[model samples]
Target: MTSDNKDRLGSKLHDVEAAREDQWARQRDADLLEKMRERMSKTACPHCKQFLVAKSEAGVPLHVCPAGHGAWIDAPALKAVLKEQK
Candidate 1:
């Protein structure tokens, strides 16, 4: 093939890879939002009366009160947080 044709093919491949990466990232974000919504639907902060936001602390998914009331950490998450402190 000619050099020009090869360059065009390379550019097209790069564009396809970029588009794939963008789509993957968007899907990942959507999945995370859905998970957060599910968690929020099941629990709420007593002090603030608002849905808790999902946050990662010490590599654990912890439900955090947006109003700064506090956070809800599960048993494994609590253990991870405590271990990080020490």
Candidate 2:
């Protein structure tokens, strides 16, 4: 094949790779947004009145305040934390 043909093929391959990367990035961003929405729907902090973010500590699910206020752990999670201490 001629040099010009090889150059065109290379450019086409590069464009295809860039398009694939862009698609993957968009999918990742969409997944992150869905996770954030789920977390926001969980509950809000009582003290700070802001939406709590879901977190796991020592295999316990906890809703933590984003404003440095406090965390909300369910009865089961609280029991788990207490058990871990002993």
Candidate 3:
């Protein structure tokens, strides 16, 4: 292949990778939202005095604060939420 063609292919590969990353991020965010919605009905966030959200992150509930106060998350127990915690 010509050098130009090789460059074009490389560029296209980069674009594809970037697009995939973006799509994955969107999917994760959406999943978090759905989890939050379910928790909102019965959960509460002690940090911002709002509701808590559930998630499948890893350590704890991937709760987030849409209002910007952060997330009120807990491990084996529930406690006062932190700041910029997400």
Candidate 4:
């Protein structure tokens, strides 16, 4: 192949690789979030032993104890909530 054609092929390959990596990362994040949701749904409040209720405030997702025991915010959600407060 000519030099220009070879360079174009290399660039296209790089773009394809980057797209694949992005897709993989998105899928991995989705899987992790799904697992977290499943675990959270099954979790009971430490103090009340009642199933925690899914909730959101300031667009931050969290789990609140049905018995008014307390709330649970994952690290990412806590960070988002705190950021929004400021």
Candidate 5:
């Protein structure tokens, strides 16, 4: 094949590869977003109106807003965490 034709073919191949990578990245991002949404709490934070993310600190389970609005911990759990701090 002529050098010019080979260069064009190589450019096309590069474009194809870039398109595939872009598609894979978009799919990956979508999957990650879905998983994150699934893990989020059904309840909304009263302070921020955002969904909460469940977490454990010092073995105490609590729901925290992703916006850093505030965390929801039951009275007993709060006592446990505070007691442990002392």
Candidate 6:
């Protein structure tokens, strides 16, 4: 293969690897957050046993517990961030 082609291939592979790593990191973080949320919700919220329910108020998705003590995960935050687009 030509040097230019090899360089392009290497760059593309690097980009793909970077993207995949980023996705994996975000997923791992999400999993951790979910576990933490469940533990917190079970101890904090009276309504939710070990999970926070997603609710929407005017389009902003919120991960709120029954007792109203929970955190916003990445998806919920993304939804909130997109609120301005709507």
Instruction: Compare the candidates by TM-score and give the number of the best one.
Output: 4
What are the clashing pairs of model 2? none
Query: Any runs in candidate 5 off by more than 4 Å, and if so which?
Result: 41-86
Give stretches of model 2 more than 4 Å off: 44-86
Per-residue lDDT for 29 in model 4?
Answer: 87
Local distance difference test, each candidate? 0.84, 0.80, 0.65, 0.87, 0.82, 0.69
lDDT of 4 by residue, 16-75 (tens): 999999999999988987877788989998887988888876667788898899989899
lDDT of 2 at 43: 73
Measured with C-alpha atoms, the lDDT of residue 53 in candidate 6 is 63
lDDT by residue (20-68, candidate 1, tens digit) is 9999999998997687669665797998788888887766777889999
lDDT of 2 by residue, 18-73 (tens): 99999999999789657655855567777867888877777666678899798777
Candidate 3 stretches greater than 4 Å from native: 42-86
CA shift of 73, model 4, Å: 2.1
Displacement of the residue 25 alpha carbon in candidate 5, Å: 1.1
The collision pairs in model 1 are none
Candidate 6 lDDT tens digits, 12-86:
999999999999999998997677556545543444564666565565545676566664545656876778679
Models 1 onward score TM values of: 0.50, 0.47, 0.48, 0.69, 0.46, 0.50
Clashes of each: 0, 0, 1, 0, 0, 0
Displacement of residue 16 (Cα, Å) in model 3 is 0.6
Q: Per-residue lDDT of 1-86 in model 3, one digit per residue for the tens?
A: 99999999999999999999999999998997676567664665556666654554554555665565666454432532333354
Regions more than 4 Å wrong, model 6: 44-86
